[model samples]
Target: MNDKINLNYLESYAHSFTEKVCSEYFGTKKYMSGQEIIQLSPSTQVNLMVIKTLFEKWNEELEMLKANPYFDYKDMAVTEALKEFMNVLSRAIKIEKQHFIPLLEVALIDTVLLAIDPLVYFWGEIEKNPSPFHHLKASKKYIKWHEKLFSELISKGDHADEEAYKKTLSEIYHQHENQLSSPHILLQDLNKVLPLDWDQLIPKEEILTETAPIMQEPAQENPVFFEEEETPELPQETAAPAEPVDYRTSDQGEIDAPKPSLGNGKSIDPALAWARFEAEQGGLLKGPIESLEEGIAINQRFMFTKKLFDGNPDLMNHAFKSIDECDSFVEAVELINERYTSRLEWELDSEEVNEFLHLVYRKFDEK
Candidate 1:
């Protein structure tokens, strides 16, 4: 009658379709009651995280039953529960994991059916007895299922609510947005039975031409597919080599600006600009730098000593008095790291700290 009924209908449809498909193909027997597929109550809002967690739990249970034959596969109740559980998990896997962890081509067909519309493939009459289960389904079967569902649910005398029907279809589309391989086809099929303007719901750019009906071809000894023709290549151009521009160093023997400057007279050297920015930002580091004052002092002395001997370990002498005092780069880093850590509280050994250090080093590497 409303959104609630519409939502419930989809939930029921998914469950019923899942159970029917399982029974028809997976050697499962029909049972009176099946496990819940979509666990969300009518009032609960659907969330991706919640759905993912539910799917993970459902998958774990399904796998447990499937891996051990000790769990009776023949019991109608067990079989039905397994099918419904798999249906729920399969939907979730399709929605989230298909792109990441894909199945083999042979298995993906039934898996997609269990997710999209299991009822039509499982219950409706088709050309093949076993239906191949991998090929495109006959268009007639799709049309028949559509008409049957519409007549029974949407077009019935008192139950016929056009708005509810549209809302339900919209919800179905939204839910399966990621999972359905061809939502356009489903919309086209639905348009055949309903009087509603289905094209309006689909943007013109996405609307596909009517797919040709699957032809019933006789089996051949050696079926061949036509190879695609390759386009001719364009002629190559020979170009003069260009000189490389130095990004790190300027003619003034200072770091260059990270960004290119416009032809304004107020252009600034990048290294000096970066140092000024760091010093200005240092004011925010008072609290954190105070906490790591010892580590900073030790690191600073190490850098200062290293600079005095030109990075030569054998020339190190803490007692040498002739070395001139210049501002240490690590001091600037200590301030930057402290400021960042005050807000985010990252460890000194963390990947973020390592990356930040490398970025700072690269800024000074031009010299």
Candidate 2:
């Protein structure tokens, strides 16, 4: 509530978090104050706005997790919490364009707190101490215990330099792989664990100092050298072709055409965006669909879907019709492709628009 109290709580939470991780990774019992934690690297420029924003978001998610019906879902709740923390850390870093370094460090600290430490601290107290207030009160012993259910509730949910954060952390962890331990070792093997991008986040000097030859293995083991395995083609099923319409004729039924919305601002039509997304992803429907569901859930959480659902009711119905009627996921996507190809009107074909459409469609799927 009060400024001083909030600041103290923030620092204390961070301190406990950092201390646990540092103790595990560096094998040091040193108590790092929150300020010291923030100052781990001389290059990092701390931003209070970024730090406060991170804490507020984490706290909100933690509260939601604490209220989960643990019995019904079994360990689903626990695993969801860990995954949620991972998502938060990755996203916090990915989104913070300005204070990236500081945010990345702080978020890593929180990730270790929520994802790793909780399996030890919170799970022990969770059954006995069900209330979020009670769990939070035990902060020193169990940092953010409530975060165990963080990923379970309705949520929203990466890549490229867009993933500069993970790349930065992987580099840091790999550079110090020998010096660090346990989870730090695990974090360093990021490519094996999860994919990330952006090599420009860290200073060259720091990266150079730890230039001990990183152990390399066979092609399969080394992600950098591992060639992308070509996707196996699915057995094609022929369907009766729909009546043809010349997409180049006009912008009338053409959803792919770029048009100014009600306002003068040029916006890609949502209908067209969905089409291009399916087109680009091609047969890769599983990953995109999962992402789409997550984005839709987030939109629902933020109340962004209500107005769209209220207005374009039929459009929404038609979209889901593809989902329900199509034989397979790829078929579902093919339906989208067919819909767009029939009405396509864009002058130039841009892969960039396809990429952007893939991103936007995931955020709002038709019900």
Candidate 3:
């Protein structure tokens, strides 16, 4: 009736539910909801809110019960009291999954308490029996017993109830400080799943890291090189150099100027200018005609030669030992065309090919 929940009173209602009565009504000979579990209408928030508060109240009561030594009813090495409390909760809390989280938190807390109680009991026994051999051995023996189940349970619930699990583990950790300090299984919580019958699967994580993605630096088009067009310009003659070009022809006694003029320079020797000024203007008098025209001509000659070779391949009838010895392109072409082209007759009649060409030319055998 009170807005505040009473955990003890609720548990009593659960304790009073008879198994036969449970079977008769709810048809399960198991945990019974203590008449107070919230089963509010889907549209109502108030009842759900009250149930939420009661869920917290139940958790507090379970913790209080643990603090009192009297409620450790499952004194067995592995206790099922967590299952018992969850049964009470399944009955008392709203059963719908959307409302189940807090009730589940209750079960988680019970497991936390279950794990913690053994350490408390073992140490308490040591205090009462105080002897180096008896107490130390007693502590180690119980710790060994606890470790078997403790590791598995903590690992399963590691992330499930982080804070409470950590607290419970830390208490057990320090209480049995030496034993817990030994090496732990280096399991990397790496999870994978497959169909039930599949025994093994290649972990995507392993394969992804090992393989490198294919590097396709986008196709770089062959950069085009074109010849700059040459323009005729007047020559600026440079003064003759001291090295004395016997500009005279060796056979005909006459002076020869450098055969072709570089044109822009008026002296045989280059002119001098202030380095800074020349550098600032980005180099003086680089006639685009001299630099780009020569390169353009070279590429054009190479491209033309390539086209001539490809367009009319010189086929050979029989191998010729030498080209200068053979003397002409006509001599080469006459020999090979007779062998390769003469072998096949494409007068167009295979059942498949004729059918394909027929479709292409005649639409179909329309009749």
The candidate scoring highest on TM-score is: 2
Error of 3 at 162 (Å): 9.3
For candidate 1, lDDT tens digit of each residue in 263-337? 122222234434543443212112222112221222222332233234332333322211112133444444443
Least lDDT summed over 10 consecutive residues: which range in candidate 2?
243-252
Candidate 1 Cα deviation (angstroms), residue 12: 16
Pairing residues by index, what is the TM-score of model 2?
0.24
Q: List model 3 lDDT by residue over 51-123, tens digit each.
A: 4345435545765766877556457632465546555553543343334333433332222222223333222
Clashing pairs in 1: 256-270, 257-270
lDDT tens digits by residue: candidate 2, 11-52: 334444434434453454233323433343311212222333
Best by lDDT: 2
Per-candidate Cα lDDT values, in order, are: 0.29, 0.32, 0.26
- Descending-TM-score candidate ranking: 2, 1, 3
The segments of candidate 2 whose C-alpha lies over 4 angstroms from its true place after superposition are 1-33, 43-50, 62-289, 293-329, 338-348, 356-367
lDDT of 3 at 39: 26
- Candidate 2 residue-wise lDDT at 105: 44
